[model samples]
Target: MRLRNIPGAKESLQQHPSIIIPNPSENKGNWKAVFGNDNPIHVEVGTGKGQFLIGMSKLHPNVNFIGIEKYDSVLVRALEQAKEEERPNLKFLNEDVEDILTFFEKAEIERIFINFTDPWPKNRHEKRRLTYKGFLDMYKQILVKNGEIHFKTDNQGLFEYSLESFSGYGMTLHHVSLDLHRSGMEGNVMTEYEQKFSRKGMRIYRCEAKFRA
Candidate 1:
């Protein structure tokens, strides 16, 4: 997906102190202070256009939701959408996932959502996949014991690879679905890409994996 450059995206994000956190790394280990309550923190990596995070924040007001997106152009759209809704429990992070550890402390996050992440199809780029062991290890360091990663994708190859990766890492998988929309799962919030792809007859795969510590 080609993203058109959104002028002043960075500036807009900086201006919205209530919605986007500036220099989030400085708040590492003290995220609960930022939220002003001891609520379970759930992060959505690669939150495109912010639909899932926004919807989840609205549905679960007791849980704090953070949307992380790297591209300023893509994140700007989400920031704009968030402006329309007043969700105190929701926040956005305009940063790369590679520095994720620097933004939170160990066992700081309770859950992670990887919705329609980039497949990184090339075999050489397998390590870059969000479900790769390296990333999972990082997640384990930040996630509380029994915390789970909820993943969804329309790419079968990526889904298969992720299942193998998760299993190889000794993570337990549950609620595996080849067609999430047809699975009749309750409380599933559809992302923007999920809605688009499922509308075009694409098979949506989903699963939840946890590293029992």
Candidate 2:
């Protein structure tokens, strides 16, 4: 984060009491109500510093958004961004994604976004990746049939590995781009990391996986 965005950031995070999920399990099936919307729900896993979800919520008010992050420090920064944006349709969960199923019922989530997720490059830590089968299985339980997962990363290894994982899970793949910024895909929301890395001319890999019914 820039020094310009730091001042008053702490106070801004305290402003939205309802947006922070203190107990994720206790909020089971209550996410839609939290945003005060019955529309389709879109969630962002590992919302580092909050730029992506807040930006998306600002542009698309009709759709609801929930950002989940495990690190309190990281989440605090992201929460401040969401607060600064004053997004009515955006909320957050400060917990591990393993609790996502308990917080949402079957087919409750309509779309999921995983942007610049941890690559977990080591073979021993493969399960920690958000696209890992364990995590995908958990996502599948809550995602509606035809629900989709959007991902963008600069890691070729993770991108290739994730495509195989999605295929293994029988997902329908679309928009498989090895260099997203140069792929001519318009209307793309750039995350803080994407903006930083893309400026250095790194090719960004992206894909969307739909869990077919």
Candidate 3:
């Protein structure tokens, strides 16, 4: 997706320190201090527009939600919408996922949500996929043993590739859905892309994979 550069988007994001964390790497293992509670923290890797994360924060008040988006233009939209609601449990990280391990120490994260990420269909670009083994290894470092990754996408090829990746990594899959909207699952928060795709009659795939204990 081509992102249109928004003027002052970076400045707007910086203004909201309470919502957008500054010097996140410094927080490291002190995320509990950042949130001032011991509530489990859940992160969304590519939180486009923050629709799903925002809705989740409202639905699960006890869980701390942090959204990691690299682009200032895209992240600013989430920061704007988040201001309307006073969510002490929600925060944003304007950083690349490549350094994700630097922001949080081992076992710091409880759950991860990856929704509608780029398919990167080329065979050579397989390593760039979020579900790639390399990316999964990064996730394993910070996630608690038995921690879960909940992934959703409209791309069938990526879904198939991810299933194999997860299985190959010895992760156990649960609640797998080939067509999420028709799966009768409750309390599923839909991302902006998910809603748009569903409106166009696209099939949505979803699964929850857990690291071995």
- Which candidate achieves the best TM-score against the true structure? 3
Off by over 4 Å in 1: none
Better of 1 and 2 by lDDT: 1
Clashes of each: 0, 0, 0
lDDT of 2 by residue, 23-60 (tens): 66766777776767688999999888889988898888
lDDT of 1 by residue, 1-213 (tens): 677998888888888977889899999999989999999999999998999999999889999999999998888888888999988899999899988999999999999999999999999999899999999989999999999999999999999999999999999999999999899999999999999998999999999998888
TM-score against native, each model: 0.98, 0.91, 0.99
Q: Stretches of candidate 2 above 4 Å error?
A: 1-15
Deviation in Å, model 3, residue 109 alpha carbon: 0.5
Give the whole-model CA lDDT for all candidates, comma-separated.
Answer: 0.93, 0.86, 0.95
Candidate 2's TM-score reads 0.91
Residues 41-133, model 3: lDDT tens digits: 999999989999999999999999999999999999999889998799999999999889899999999999999999999999999999999
Error of 3 at 17 (Å): 0.8
Clashing pairs in 2: none
Weakest 10 consecutive residues, lDDT, candidate 2? Answer: 1-10
